[model samples]
Target: MDKKDRFTEVVKTNQGLIFKVATLYTNNLQDKEDLYQEIVFQLWKSFDSFNEQSKLSTWMYRVAMNTAIYNLKSGKKQVNTIPIDLETERFAEVLDKTEEEKIKVLYEKIQMLNLLEKGIILLYLEGKNHQEIASIIGITISNVGTKISRIKDKLKSQIKTT
Candidate 1:
């Protein structure tokens, strides 16, 4: 396929990944949508330089995350509240209310994390291995392990207190 076709396919396949990263950075729907668009724009702009050494999803994650961090640091965006519990009854019906409440509380805790910790935890929750998380975040593999351990401990303590 041509470059355009390839890029289209990559974005289509990884839209969910994009949205997840966007959600991590922004709270409300409008802000998340804005961040998502910004991420997509950056991804398309950088597509030409995306070497195939990393998996496409990894590259997408890195791009989306960098965009998010940059946006957060720029002071141009406001902190907004996440509305994960605003979904309709279908989700509520599928998940036990207790499970849903736990997830909501987990996300609330996640919102309290610093930017780097948030990225690390999101990658971990997505099932990325340590090496992959290290590669994506430009840290050593050992640092990824250390950071994950600390973040998990912090989350556990915070969750317990809440």
Candidate 2:
């Protein structure tokens, strides 16, 4: 198949992954759509560079997470992350009420965190190990562990107070 076909297939298959990243990084529908488009653009831009050194999902996560982080840091592109209308929020696919509730709470808390922290926690919740998290974030394994602990502590405090 041609590059376009391959890229299209990959994007279609991984649309959920992109949507989740976009949702986690944006405040509202407009912002989510914007980020989602930008991430797709980025993935297309970088598609040729995927060296097969890691899993396709891992590469997608790295790219999508980096795009989200960049969007967060860019002053003109910055958008508020406060959860609004979370009852109306969608988690990409249908989930049980209890599972959805837990995810919603976790998302609310993650939205409160900085972009970098959100990336780490998102990866963690997605079942990425410390090494994978560190690699994606361009940090040390030890640093990932430290940050995970710190993030856990912060989440605990936030959970208790909320």
Candidate 3:
């Protein structure tokens, strides 16, 4: 396939990854939509140069994560919260009440984290292994583990206080 076609296909397959990253970093619907487009544009800008050393999804995640982080830095956080979207509603539909509450609490705690902590924890929460998290965050594999342990501790403390 051509580069554009291949890029389109890859993006189509990984839209959820972008959406999640955007949602995680942005505080409002407009910022989320803006971040999503910025990520896709960055992916396309760097598309042809992406070598296959890592998994495609991993590369996509790295790009999306970086773009989201950059967006968070540039944009102001809105005080008003967004209503849960349809995808979240669909996800909550299957989970029992407890799991839903737990996830909601975790997400709220995550908002208190710094940018790097947020990135590492989000990747860890998404089931990324240490090496993948390291790759995405450009940190040492061991550092990823340490950061996650610390982030968990921080979340635990936040949970207790709230």
lDDT of each: 0.83, 0.83, 0.82
Top lDDT hit: 2
Tens digits of per-residue lDDT for model 2 on 28-109?
7777777888889899999999977778988999899888878876625655544433233454356888887887787799
Mark the regions of model 1 whose C-alpha exceeds 4 Å error after superposition.
Answer: 73-99
CA lDDT of 48 in candidate 2?
A: 97
The CA lDDT at 12 in model 2 is 91
Error of 3 at 55 (Å): 1.9
Model 1 clash pairs? Answer: none
List model 1 lDDT by residue over 20-132, tens digit each: 78877887766666677778889999999998986887889989999988876653555553433323355468898799898788788889999889988999999999988
What RMSD, rounded to one decimal, does every model reach? 4.5, 4.9, 4.4
Q: Which regions in candidate 2 have their CA more than 4 angstroms from the true location?
A: 73-99
lDDT for model 1 comes to 0.83
Across 64-93, the per-residue lDDT of candidate 3 in tens digits comes to: 988886776767655444343434566668
Q: Once model 1 is optimally superposed onto the true structure by TM-score, how far is the C-alpha of residue 141 displaced, in angstroms? A: 1.1
- The predicted structure with the larger TM-score, 1 or 2, is 1
Candidate order by decreasing TM-score: 1, 2, 3
